[model samples]
Target: MHLSNQGLLVILVVGVVAGWLAGRVMAGGGFGLIGDLLVGLVGAFIGDWLMPQLGIHLGVGIVALIINAFIGAVVLLLILRLIGGGFGGRRRWI
Candidate 1:
């Protein structure tokens, strides 16, 4: 399919916002512009798929989209941390 310019813009904005929000909440700060955008975009995909599986729907709208992405981003960050990616670089023993 084809996506309009406006649609693409909206996706970028949402990804940035969601990524920043998740970084701040999980990492206690933003992960720069590019980092935030990447995290958000990947998170958006996770949220879009995981949300429905867990029976969690935030309705429809820009706000809902952001919420979904934010949730997904948080989850992503948490997973990364558990795997010792950004969790103080400490190796977990368990």
Candidate 2:
């Protein structure tokens, strides 16, 4: 969706926080600012795509957005872990 400047800022901040949290949960620490930001941004895309297929509708609002992004980030991390591959790897899954 198209976000205004303020909305984008909010997403950035939320995504950073959510990514950091996911990193901590998965890797035992934060992935640094840039790493976290990337994860969060990608997570937003994942959530936007996956949530609908899963029949999970969080609706709108800042809280829903944050929740969606955070959940997606965590799922991405988990998938990465299970696949035992880094982002540079051509095959992320076995």
Best by lDDT: 1
Predicted structure 2: clash tally: 0
Over the full model, what C-alpha lDDT does candidate 1 score relative to the true structure?
A: 0.91
Per-residue lDDT of model 1, residues 1-94, tens digit only: 9999999999999999999999889855677899999999999999999999999889999999999999999998998877866754455679
TM-score of each: 0.88, 0.77
Model 1 TM-score relative to the real fold:
0.88
Worst 10 residues of 1 by lDDT: 84-93
Model 2 lDDT tens row, 1-94:
7779997799798799778877877754667899899888888889889999999999998778878888889898888777976444265365
Candidate that scores best on TM-score: 1
lDDT of each: 0.91, 0.82
Clashes of 1: 0
